[model samples]
Structure formats: structure tokens, C-alpha cells
Target: MINFKIRYTLLLFAACISLQACKKAWQDHTAITIEALNKTLIQQINETPDLSTFSTYLVKTGYDKVLASSKSYTVWAPTNTAMQTIDAAILADTAKLRLFVANHISYQEYFTTAPNPSLVIRTLSGKNIIFTPATFEEAKIVKGNVYVKNGVLHTIDQASGTKQNAYEFMMSTGLSTKQRGFIQSLFHTEIDTSKGVKLYTDPITKKTIYQAGTTFPVTKNTYFQRVSDISSEDSLLTYIILSDVAYDAEKAKIGRYYNLSTSATKTDTLTQFAVVKDLVVNHVYTIDNLPDTLTTVSGVKIHLDRSAIIQTQKLSNGIAYVVSSIGYQILQNKIPVIYIQGELPDSVRVPSTLSIRTKKDLNDVKYTDMQSRSITSSPDPLYYYRYKTTVNSAQYKVYWRAVNDIFTTSFNQKVDFSATRYYPKAVETPLATMGYKAVAVSDYSEVYLGLYTPANYGTLYTFLVSATGVVSTAPSALSLDYIKLVPVN
Candidate 1:
């Protein structure tokens, strides 16, 4: 009985020890599994042998900390073999290396099972990468959807080479020198108050005043704001870089309207801006899909001569074509028609006596017309509607719409042009011998005025004179709706 009792006691002790050992093993296994689930993107990359090269680059660029952060990111890590193909020069330069690594990482997590078939994602380097289910840009995705604590990681078969954007391409020296210099010269800096902390509120103006030294300087280019933003990766654009010869030729054709100043420098600057303003179109047209003509964002139609292409560069945000010749029609695209509203004249003679009547025309379009309220019999009472504007040194055909609905008697009117505001000394002959006679009844149609050529490109004063010496009521009074000056090339 003693032997049996001792054996039972030993068996019970052994079973308790075995149960304790199994419990400890299960606890350790759970701890390791939880640790693997908590691994970050950087940790995952560092552990993978195939992505060791990319992991080394991330450490060199100090982007490993960025990946380890709490913010979500998607990393397209290149395999060890793929990293070998990268340019040595890029790795040598810190800026290039940083940019190259940033190009592979994006802000948000991306997965292979995304709803969209393809996406143009802006990377941390400010460049766009084309992401599809099967590829990252030109690189084939070897492994994807490897989720980490903060983001997802994907292994790529090859590394995508960094390409310059449209704006960056223009910044390159020795390429489109004139256009690049002009664009660079437009760069200026302004204080960004939003980046600074508020110092106090102004009591007088009720405006928040930011701390003077706290504000950061922001670089701005007028071309980017007024024209296309070629630096942006959100939209694709087609940029045309004109060669020096083509630029000069196009500038000369469009310089007539911009010849407001006598200074050659001022005229050249204005002409240059006008010439380059319409060069960027808001669409990407590859060489194979390029159309015969491209309409610019500013609505100028330009004929594209494929033969004139000096070089074509595929950019990250867009494509650029360096062309030696681009043709623009002077009359159709360069010069626009000028419309002068009679009610909004620069200066009018006898303002108190003139009446501005607002009415609707046959097309139910609302319009305002100017009419003379003078009822004097004085000969040539100086009852004239004068207007001032800048004009090119070109011939123009004038047309006017003067509705005579309130007038019972038909009256005559004529137009005169001069460089100065003084009366007489006509630049060109008046329309007709008796001038234009208004219809006795209602007439909403425009009357044709004879062609008048300006002597030079400067401010011009036009006088719309009424018939001399006539007592006038609403009828027989001078009336004008608007005038149109159509440029004749």
C-alpha cells in the first residue's frame, strides 16, 4: 500500500509540472504572434531579405523614421536586384537620393484590391506615379498588399527612374534658354502669414497680425498663377517650349497690340508674356495621339507642325515638346475684337444732358443706350459722345447698334477718330457723306460704319457726332447702343 501511494503522488506531481510547462509555451507563442502583428512598414522592409537594398537606401536618406511614424504610407520597395540598376550619380547626391526614395512612397495606404483599376498617385517627392493592380509605373509588382501596422508594403521587380516635371524641365539650363530665363525671372517671394503664428489683432482694422519673424517666405511665379501650373502633379498638361527663333517670330506678330510703351524693354517683356501665356494646353497629347491643332487654355488655337519638333520629353506631370516653329494666325487668334459700350464711355460731352436708357432688344437681351436730351437750335452744339481706348496700328471696320424705338423722326450720326482728345483733325475719313441715318421706326440692327485706320499703336479718341443745328425731342436725338471695332488683318 505504501509503494502504491508513493507512485500515485509522483504521477500527480509530474502531471502538474507538464501542465505548467504547456501554459508557459502557449503564453510565449501568443506574445511573439502579437509582436509580428505590431511590426511597422520600416520593420517589415528591414526584415525582408529581397528589400534589403531599398532598406539601406531608406536608412541613408533618413526616411526610415518617416516610415516608422504613425502616419499611414504605401511603400513600393524595389528588390535587391532592381536597386542595382539605379544610377550611381543619384545615390551620390543627397538631394537626388532623397527624391528618388520619396518617389516610391505615397501618403495613404494603397492595396491591390482598390476600387479603381488605375490611379495617378502623387508621391512624397511631388512627382506622380501611375499605380495599377499589376504595376507601379513601369515596374511590375512582385508582391503587394503586405499590410503593416502603419501602412502597406509592396515589392517591385524594378525601380522607376525619376523624371522631371514640366516646370523642372524648363528650369534646366541650355534647354529653351530664352523661355526658361523669362520664367525664372518671374520668380518672387512673399510672406506667408498662414505659416506664422498670430501676434495680435489690430484694433483699428480688426485684422489679425502675425508675428513678423515667424512668417515664412513663399516663392511665387506669376506664370504659374496666371498661366498653367506646370509644377502641379494633380493634372496632366501639354507644354510647348518655343525655340528662340520661333519665340521671336511669334512675339513680333503679337507685339502690335502690346506696343503701349515706347520703351523697347517694356514692349519685349509684354510681348514675351503674351507669347508664352498660351503655350501650355490642359491635356497630355503623346506624339502618336497629337492632333494637327491644339487649343490652349487661354483659348488660342495654334497649328502644331510635327516636323518642327526639336525634342520631346515625357514628364512626370505632363509632356513637353520643344518646337522650332509654331504658327498663329494674326487676325483670327492673336487679335480680338473690341466692343465699346456706349453707356460706359471713358468721357462724355455734356454728361448732365445725356440720358442712358436701359431696354431689351428683340432677342430679349438687356442693353443700355446713350441718347442726347438737348433741344437747342444752336448750330453744332458740340453734342458728341466721346470714347477713349488703346488701339493697334491696324485698320478696323466699325459697326454700331442704335435702337430708335422712342424716336419718331430719323436722325443722322457720324464717328471720328483722333490721337488726342481735341475736336477735329480726323485720323480717317468719316463713314458716309451724310453720315448714318437712324430709322424713323424701331430698329435694333447694327449699321455698318466705314473702315478707319489708326496712325500708330496708342490711345485713340472716338467722337460720335450728331447732326448740326436741330431742335430735338426723343425723336431726332442722338442715340447709340454699342459700337464694335472689328480688326482687319
Candidate 2:
């Protein structure tokens, strides 16, 4: 979150749009303009037979009386058809019922006669309501002659900001058409896989499926980026795209028992060391790894961090190690992934003169592979470049090759970045400032709390160079984002 109050402004603006839509009007008989929606009240909302289940929810939540009050509201009234479409069982549940419908209301005064075609309104629920593709005619008279009523109502097709993240658990093996509980609060949805991209269908809106390989439209706070399966033929990598939020899996108390090869029991917590390392090590262990189908389980997912176990040099009977950083920190054999989302209009031709700076006192300089792909007009923002530098006395090798989004896989000392485009308007002219930045850490492993060390001190910097992608040997000082000292215990 930007920690800025930008949204507060939008909320107020939306309310103004909705409230102003249906102006109050006085019939030739009544002198004062009054809200028209008062005429078409929510007369009777029957939860019994289900003409509109949401109306029943409004009644149950005590909002029915609230609506009857003088306070005006803009309700995204779902038709009886939409209401009946909800599962009968779900409609019967009082809890799910409240959230489903109560979340739809806005308190901005809208009259039944408001003629405005398109206006954004604020919900009593404080959600912004944008009514588009609409019109205004005899509804709320414009300007003078009418000072407008307290409220008006305008029908709208869609309500904005619906729970896009609501996971419906659409389709999975053995999962019944009958709704099981939603994958209780899905954490991160994507995962890195040895078996290409993986996908899962949302349970509710069954049609929407999330596939890996590329960015999926972010839904809700829990964006379904990728799904990695340890219960598969290939289980070394854990797939991750963009997680909707920093998932708190600990309290969720989710996930199933481990599915080791030689186990019959479902919840076994201990296994031999060899089995531990083989089954799980570098892969990202998560809470949602449980499958709907039953599976044999052996050994628990170990967390050997300070929070979990006392630190010592002794090799664990189990191989799991927990670090502060989330997900897979270091993959012995990295899968270098890069995707060129969108590139600049002009072709980027790197100036022939290029220089590589191997930071001193740093062992390994890890730049996966050079990618000339499109993301933003800029190339750096398009790809994530990690340099897993070692402490000292280590050789670094890098080669240029065309790569997909995964870039950590192969390295040949000789490289060809020609296919890769330079970000921020590829420098063609002999340049001075490129604003390229890098974190020259001693070791990425040292960034974690206890694993860090004084030797891990590194610099984050931008380099000045020629039109070609090389650090200018002669002209300029290196600019740094900030240099920090990280200490390892």
C-alpha cells in the first residue's frame, strides 16, 4: 500500500456522482422536491420463497430498517433471477447471506427519477459505485426550476470492485459439484514448476481459470499467479507469479500432510534425513499444498529457523530450513525466467562499447541471462535480476542467450545481450547517465536476519555510461540508492 490518502478522495468523488444523479423533484402538486425512490420502497423482502434472497439479507442484518429511514441509499438491486441463481444452501446460511448482499449497498442518496446516464456514487457501505452507459431524461430535472430531492435511484448493470479474489474451487479431481469450503483463504496462488505452467479453476465463477507461464489478471487480494504441486511427478520447483498479498499461512493452520513416496499414513511428521532433503529443500513449502483427494503422507514440513528450533551446526534429522525471506530463496540450479511484456516503440541498439564491472571483495556476480524482451518500455522493470554474490574467492560466469521469463538456469561466460534491449530509451548516443542500479551484496543468503553478516555489506547503485550498455571508464562517479551493512550471526 502506498500509505497515501489517495483513495479517500476517490471515495468522496464517487459519492458525489451517485448522489447528484437523481435530483429531487416536486410534482406540480407538491412545492418541495422530494426523493422519488421513497415511492418504490422495498415493500416486502421474503427470504422464505426467495423472490430476492439479498432483500432477506438486508432484513436479517437489520439494514432493512436502516434503508427505511430518511437516510438515502443507492442499492445495486440484483433482480429476482440473479437472487434465485444463488445456491439454495448458501442462501439458507445466515452468515454467507449477510456478506453476499450487504456488501452491495451504498448510502448516497439516489432518487428513482434521476435521469443522469452515467454517474459514480458512494455506497452506504462506503464502496464507490460507478454507473456507466446510462442516461438522464425526465428523471431528475437539471439546473434551476428544481433544487433536487434528497435522493434518487438509477439502475446499473455492474457493481465495481466485487470480490474478484473469491476462490470458488471451480474444478479439481474428486471435488463434487456440491461446494466444499473455499480453499480456506488461498495464500500465494502461483508456483514455479518443472512441468511447465500449471492452472486451477476458480470454484465460483467456474469459467475463469488461472494459468501460469504468464501474468494472470490479478483478482482480489489473493492474486492467483501460479500453482506448484509437490504431489506431482516433478516436485523440485515451486511456482510463483505475483501473490495478491503477503499470505499469513501460519495462523491459517492450513495444508495437508506431506506426500512422501514411502508413507501410508496421511499425517506423519517425521522421516529420515535422506528422505527429508530429497522430498523437500529448496522448494517453497506452503499451507495450500493439500489436495482434495487423499494421499499418503510422511514427515512434517520442518521449519528450522530461530522461531522454530534452536540454531546449531548439527545437521537436522530433517532437512527443512526456514529463512526470513518468503518462498524459495536460493535454487542450486535456478530457472532463469524472463518475459518481455511490452517494449519501447524504437529498436534498442546497444553501443558497441560495453564494460562489465565485477565488484571487488564480492565473490560471485549473478546476473542470470540477458533478455531482450518487452515488459514496460524499460527492460529492467520487465525482469527481476538477482545477483547471488558469494563472500570472496569465487569465480562468476555469465553468457548471453535468449531466455523466457526464467533466467537463472544456464551460464556461459561469453554472452550475447544483443537480443536484449536496454531499458529507459535504449542509449544510442554516447551517454553519461543511464540510471541503472544494482544491489552489490556479498551474498543474497546473508540478507536474512540471523544468516546475515558484516561481510555481507553491499551497495545499491546506478551507473553512468555511453549509449551502449557499459559503465563509462572515464567520465563519472557511481550513484548509489543506499549502501547497507548486513551482519550474520
Candidate 3:
């Protein structure tokens, strides 16, 4: 009887302990199972009755694939109430619907960490969308920080496209749309494939290597193609476009120079073509922000009329500034003028037979009698040729053609230039003197005018050549052809 009682008591105690252990196990298992059942972005949308419309649109548009992916993303989900304002026509169109959904979805998580509170995010639709936490807070984060297998999801009261990139905004307005040529010039690239083998010389080895013939197929560059494909995230560009009024006025200047017909293509070298090209190229800058002044690819200065800016747009890789005017008149025979001896205008032509005679003025200042000659005679004599350049920097390299006298002895003369100086001091000083050995008429000398720096603030800078020496002396017969001024950085 005692044994039976002891066995029964032990069995009862064992049963109670096992029941307690099973209860604890059940609690742990239930907790883990609950965690596994947590909602994903797709599930959350479907489960929430308020989000039914958004979920249905996602299904209808097939954006569920993005949500189903394991890759991380942050979705700025708009509630059914907020989405009610969206046009049904937009949702019905697959293309529009896809882009609309993509605009709301960001590829990276933003609620916990972002580069900025108002971060600029690129969506799958190839457009930039602004995601501002503060702005979202104004409407309230209806559902905040719901983590799923892929990423965290947030429901916002409202969200829409707030900003357009450089390209997008340029397309948004009719006025800016006409300025497409300017935008196109900023991001243009040419790909040329020749029909023959390329002979490349190795600079280090000084050996020649010939590649196999690439001539089987030739590829040419098309301007229209470049204009169509203008946006690149790799290279940042800033563009300044003339407003419609400004562009039309500038085009009128071109029409005055060249006859414009509708048949003329963009590539046509009409008088307005080069001017427009320079104007467009002058607007492109390799930087992101618009400074007071910027240098173009052609090394021309573009002054920003801040007060006259008609429109401004920011893009993934650059910014665009639209202004009423470039703050300067478009002039011809501008910087980088190349004058050939064979092509001289009668106004600036110096005759070969004229021998210059030096005479003293009342002040004992030596002057030359150039009454019959086209050249101006003075201590600082002026050449018949004039090249107007915009001095954006402190120095520019001047290259000129000088003809040597064949029958006379060689004489060294210091050639000085007069230029509108801008920096260090705004005074007209003798541009540094450079030496040129005049060669025989059969041969030409190409020498640099060493120290020609102009300080004219984006205005037309004129470079006048003046030589100091006795013109009547032997070996004094020198012919001047052309002077080219190239801007130095």
C-alpha cells in the first residue's frame, strides 16, 4: 500500500512538470510563428482596407514584382484617401501608371538613413523625385517603419512629383522647349568609325602598330540623335539658355548676316549658325552650380544675369539656367580670328611699295608719315588687322606671321602690343614685348607674342600690334599677315 501511494504521487508530479514544459514550449513556438507572419509591402497593402485602392492599382499596374523582390527599397506609399485625387485616366494608362508608381517607390531605404532629410532620389522611371521627411511629417507618416523581408515601408498622407530634372523641366515649358538646341549642345558626343585600319604610334616605344581594318562598316555621327539623348549621370553639366525673346533677338542678328531659308538644316553654316553655336556652347559649363560667370568649352565667358533668370532646373548630373540675355551683344570677327595674307580687306591692307618715313612731332616724340599707307605710324604703331576677343583670364597666347626681308641684313626689333588690361591693375600697358626674326618672303615666321593678357571684363578685347624700331633702316621691310590669340587657362 505504501509503494502504490509513492508511485502514484511521483506519476502525478511528473505529469505536472511535463505540462509546464509543454506550456513554455508552446509560448516560444507561438511567438516565432507570429514573427514569420509579419506583413510585407504587398501584404500590408492588401491587408489594410484603406490601402485597397493603392494595392489594386499596384496589382493592375503589375508593380507587385518590385515589392516581391528581396532587394531593399523604401516606398512612399500614398493612402487610398490621398490617392483619390489622382486622375483615373492616369492610372488606366499602363505607361503612366508604371511611371507614377515608380515615382513613389525609391530604390533605397530612407526612413532610417538618408543623405539628406530632403534627399533627391532617382526612381526606376529615370526621373528624380524628392523625398522630404519634414514635408511628409506635415501630412503625417500614417504608417511608419514597417519592416519586411526586403525593406522598410512607410505610408504617407500624400506625395507627388515636386521637381523636374534639367532635361525634364526643359521639356515642360514651350518657351524652354524651343531652347532644346542649347541643351543638346551641352551633352553631345560624336562616335566615328573609319573604313580603314588605324595606324597608331606608341609614344613610349616609338613604334607603329596597325590594327585590323575597321573599314568594313562605317558609323557616322548624327546631330538629331545627340539632341534626343541628352542626359548622362556620369558627367555633370550646367547650361544657360537664352529666353525665347533673347533667342529670337539673337537669331535676328544672325539673319542680318546670312540669308535664312526654311530648307537650311541645323548643320548649315548660315551666318547665324556660328553665332548660335557659340551662344549655345558658351552656355555649357562643366560645373553643377551657376556662378556669376562661367567658361564655355570654346573658352568664352558666360555672364549670368541672376536677376533676369527666367527659369532654373536641376538634374541628376547638372543644372540649367534660363536668362533673358547673356549680358553682352553677339559680335563677329571675335576672339580666335585667323587672318590670311591672301585674304586681306582693303581697309587694313598695307601696300608693299610704301616705304615708311619717321618724323619728329613738336613734343620730340618720333612719328611716322603713314599718310598714304594704311598702317598707323606712332611710337606705338597699329597694324591694319584687328581681332576682338573676350578676356576671361589673365593671359592669352598670341601667334603671328612675319615675313623676313630677303636682300637686307636682319635687325632685331621689340614688338609690343596694346590690349585692354583688366587684372592686377586696370590700365592700358604695353603687352609684353616678344621677338620675331623676319624671314625671307619665300618663307614665313610663326612666333608668339609672349605677354598678351587682357583684363576686359567679358567685353570685346582688341589686340593692336605696335613695333618700336626705325622703319627706314635696313631689313625693315616686314609684312604682317595674321595674329591669333588663344586663351590660356
Top candidate on lDDT is 1
Clash statistics: count for each candidate: 0, 59, 4
| Model 1 lDDT, full chain set | 0.79
Q: TM-score order of candidates, best first?
A: 1, 3, 2
Against the true structure, whose TM-score is highest? 1
Q: How many backbone clashes does candidate 3 have?
A: 4
Off by over 4 Å in 3: 1-38, 48-50, 132-144, 162-165, 168-172, 176-178, 181-229, 233-238, 252-291, 294-299, 311-322, 328-489
The sequence of per-residue lDDT tens digits that candidate 2 reaches over residues 251-311 is: 1222121223344332232211112222233343333442222111222233222332221
- Better structure of 2 and 3 per lDDT: 3
| Root-mean-square deviation of every model | 12.6, 25.4, 17.2
Determine which window of 10 residues in candidate 1 has minimal summed lDDT.
425-434
* Candidate 1: tens digits of C-alpha lDDT, residues 1-489: 999999999999999999999899545422212233488999999999999999999999999999999999999999999999999999899999999999999999888666278888889988988898779988988777777888888889999877788988878735588888888888899778877889889999998899778888899999998998888877899999988788778877788766755587877787789889989999989999999889999888888888999999889988999999887777646666777788877766653377888889889989998877443432443557778887776678888888766556676666767676755523443322225455445788888877877755667777777655452333245677888888895
Off by over 4 Å in 2: 1-57, 109-131, 134-150, 155-489
Each candidate's TM vs. the true structure? 0.75, 0.27, 0.49
Q: Assess the local accuracy of residue 365 in candidate 1 as a C-alpha lDDT between 0 and 100.
A: 88
